[model samples]
Target: MSEALVAAETPGTGIEPVPGVSGARQFWRRLRAQRAALVAAAVVALLILVALGAPLLTAIEGQDPTTYHPSLIDSARGGVPIGSFGGIGGHHWLGVEPQTGRDLFARLVYGARVSLGVAFAATVIQLLVGVVMGIASALGSGWVDQLLSRITDIFVAMPLMIMALALLAIVPSSFPRPVLVTLVIGFIAWGNIAKIVRAQTLTLKGLDYVSAARLSGWGTWRIARRELLPGLAAPIITYAAILMPVNISIEAALSFLGVGVKPPTPSWGQMLTAADVWYQAAPQYLLLPAGSLFVTVLALTVLGDGVRTALDPRAASRLSIGTGRKREAKAAKGETEAGKSASAVGKAATEAGNGTTEAGKEGSA
Candidate 1:
């Protein structure tokens, strides 16, 4: 069998291992080991798929969600009910809204698209701004670092929600598109991430590899990219994962305040708003979207925790140190055995020399 095949078949039989596993494989293995993280990831993926396929699913039932269907009210009044909620039957799995009798399920599915899209876009923007700004501040010394630090402090001190509300109040109505909302949230949310990146950069910039790169005539950008950035992978990924939930919450809050994606554009926050009146009566209306939001947030959080634990170099170093100590102890035993053999050889040589001298003296006599 091939070496690779043999390794695959045999438990713990493989090529010589390194100090740490390869990044991608290690991440996957760690994520899989974390049951909660895996479950959360699955739920998020399923929700995304459902949102993307909403159109096809809605079409199969032969109902137009946007169009007003008065027949639904008649069926509701009759109390016999034609559909799930006396509406359009299986076509509307979540029942119709009381006001317009619109398919709630369809709206919710469409809303998922908006919510996820906005959150993802915002997160990307935040990552870009925060990473760049942080690296710059950390590497730049004296006045530049001080200035950037002060700027970060200013942003961090501001009340984020209130600031968002104020900006929304002044902005034109046409600018409430998903992209715009993402940009707005991203800009404001970068402060915390920037601080994290800055601290990481400061630590990495002083590392031996970074200093070597600088001495080799590499520029600051090159050193940052080649020497510093690789070490930042764990922190960057963990932070990004943690940030997703925060961005989603921000979008939802904005939506709740009537400043988010407008009506007909379905968003989880907007859906929650629409269901507020019926929340006490039909709690499912509120529970559905809220539950989804909760699951997504929880999943990201767990995933972050898994990443943090898996990628922590200090923990890995401690494990390696323990392993090293065992090897050292074995070496010490081998050295002791060699010492005993050497001592015996020396004693035998000494006795042979003494006997030879005695024989010489007897011969002389």
Candidate 2:
């Protein structure tokens, strides 16, 4: 068929074809395709479960993380006897602390709770504040952007550790010092997230749909919320996933420095601090909490990478390799159609030539 005929016969829908997949579903599909993501998610989930089931996992009674068994402590050596995690049993599963003889298993489980809780809470705080400030900056006018940008820059440049130390120095020694640390860290860390979200929002606000929404008489709040917010979800969620491990590490560090969750309330950092002195006598004491922290951080880091990859359209294309759209099929179909068309045209011309030649021959005869 002629090009014009093909055009006439083709389906009409002037609008660009939207991809058949919803972003969230596509992201999930991509994540499910990745082995690393599944492994990381499983590890993270296990840690969360251990944290939540802290009490049930450990034997109740004198095994409280804070309750010390001086009898079990080797006073002469200033540490507890060497014990392997593989030897866990009735009284002590993971082992016992070096100097205090507190059940290591109980402390480890309880510590997970404190560390994960603070990290999650702090991340939520930072995410909310960052998203709000970011959207505000994008939706606002010249001076507003300038003011928010300047504020963001100031925080971005500030030293996080020094600021944390200064703030925590005045914080009263309390059972749940994790709360104060979380709030403070979240407040300080929001600036970077705001900057990221603001950049994304600025780009999104200029998109065609945003302008169309505004022209349709939508209010600023409605435009910001309905038009631009959804576009920001992927990056925000990915960044938040990465940031949770950071928050956990920071809380742990603060606890080690003696300004985080106070004594009696176990935290990974505090356990590390307490175990540091008896490393020579019982290496397991130091290694246990440190290993947990390392594993948790590693899992979160992997999960963040997976989430980012899954959410990214370009990255998803790579992961979806053999299972996605069949462009080769479309190419083959085109070639087949072209080959059939060429054969038909050639046959028609040959027949027409034969008919004319026969007519000429008849006239001569």
Candidate 3:
């Protein structure tokens, strides 16, 4: 019984202790504590799942979204039509479109595919262009940097929307494929990213690691790939997150202007265009797509903010208790050292006083 009690009292003798927290673990622990980041992650995950699984879900309804249904309302009298409001004694949940009588829910689902696809593709292209241009300019001597910087400046000063509009006006409204629109947006948007990447590269190139690599006879490409790129990871991730929303917004705006993703494609922007006439009566039509865009953009912005905070060394330090604990430990060490000095001084003073008194007594004697 006593052995059992001792064994019970002993703290997990067979179990290993938890490992010490690492920098990554500490950062993740801090991030998890943030309520906004948690919520934003959840929302973004849900959106991604919806975007990817849209086709599967739409097929389960036994409805063809692309096919036109002329008498959707009349059909709903017997059975629910694709877009009929569920609780309103109709087969459709969101109500049928007045002109085409298409399913609103189905269209929204399909639209997600278009919006997210374009945003991702454009972001990737922008990153590639920006990273290459920025690194090239940073590695090159004065003339090359100056030329690239001037070109970047020129593009930055130009109105992007105006340029896009002029280009679309000169060319056909419909492109050969969706990729063409994505390429156009990506090519135009890369100027901003190039400037950002250039600035970062300039700062990183002066670091000791970069200098050491150069001193070791590493070429520019090797130095950039090994030394500079690793340092740029945080900013690259942050920039990518922020750029996604911008691309989405640009795609929507172009679509709204009748220059992006031709009609009948079921884009959120195209949905908005269709809802313009019914703005006063059936505001839900406009509100649905607009609301989706607003939420998606807002979610991306929040996620980007979270990523920025997480990636920033200063912000991460502020979030972690490590900084405070380290400061306290340093102060304690300092105090200990001070106490030792005070004790040494007091001992020396006592000894000197004793010696002086003893000498005085001896002289008096």
Candidate 4:
């Protein structure tokens, strides 16, 4: 088929394809059409930047996460901040913590680092373990496949919270809390992805190219790498994007429960733990971390949904906003066309009326 024909046929494929344009460019164009996704992506990017630049940001404000400003808090009033909005003022940006009087803004920015970093690191680990185990289960001999499948089933059956608590409790405090949390979340949470990968790999394993690679005496690893990996990339990426936010929430929950990150390290969840009692007295302290967590999770979720739709445009059915916008655009176009036609008809009718009036006057003359 000609390139023009191929390009013309692609609009029905959910990606607008221009002649000579690569698939990646087409995918990007489709993604850009999702406004919510774009905004969410921007939010996520800003968060990452904030997390990365936390130290500099704190330094610029001449504040650190651990500093105490005793004067900012009212010792007489049960450690409540003296000023309004958690003692927000010139020296304190987001305000000082209730009792310790630590810079809330500084701790918030620093907390972003722990929360984002642990989630990101854990996701990477999960992706690696899931993909490897999934591929292995698919390509292995019958007994090996059975063994791996059973192992995956066991992991899936284990209660995540119980396992996490048990593991976190037994681990020594000498170990870095952030690293421990990441490892716990990553190692325990990969079962779902592994199951997904196994099913996908099995489907791909039966494809003609994969069989041909095997027929050519290629090793299992080589066949998987050369024939199956490309086919698996899209689903893997979509799942991984969706998985990160879940990991983030899990980390936060663990920290809030007092088994995640320790104090002075600055985690959103840990901050929330401390702020629970101060909710009535210092709502800003609670609201700050709570709001941050809510926004982060929401943005990540939207971004993940966008990625899934971008990778497989058929999934755009789930994005009501995108479909709604398309509907509105079509309606607007119809209205515009209708108005233009109505105006043209009116113009023609007025001209005809003028002609008739002129003919009657000529007859009278």
Task: Judging by lDDT against the true structure, name the best candidate.
Answer: 4
Q: Estimated TM-score per prediction?
A: 0.76, 0.79, 0.75, 0.85
Model 2 residue 72 CA deviation (Å) reads 1.4
Each prediction's whole-model lDDT (CA): 0.72, 0.79, 0.73, 0.87
Give the local distance difference test score of model 2.
Answer: 0.79
Task: Tell me the lDDT of model 3 at 235.
Answer: 75
Query: In model 2, what is the error at residue 342, expressed in angstroms?
Result: 22
TM-score of 3: 0.75
Q: Which stretches of candidate 4 lie over 4 Å from their true place?
A: 1-19, 321-365
For each candidate, C-alpha RMSD in Å? Answer: 10.2, 8.7, 11.4, 7.1
TM-score winner between 1 and 4, please give it.
4
Q: Judging by TM-score against the true structure, name the best candidate.
A: 4
Give the alpha carbon lDDT tens digit for every residue of 267-347 in model 1: 888878877776654556678788878877777676666555445422322222454567667777988999999999999
Comparing 2 with 3 on lDDT, the higher-scoring candidate is 2
> Which digits, one per residue and each the tens of the lDDT, describe model 3 over residues 194-269?
8888898998888787798899999989988978887777778878989999989988898888777776787888
* Model 4 agreement with the true structure over 1-365: per-residue lDDT tens digits: 12112223323333555667665776677679888899999999999999999999988889999988898889999899888888888878888999999999999999999999999999999999999999999999999999999999988888888899999999999999999999998998888999998998998888787788889999999988877787788778888889889988999999999999998889999999999999999999999999999999999998989877776765543656666778768877998999999999999999999999999999999
Ordered list by TM-score, greatest first = 4, 2, 1, 3
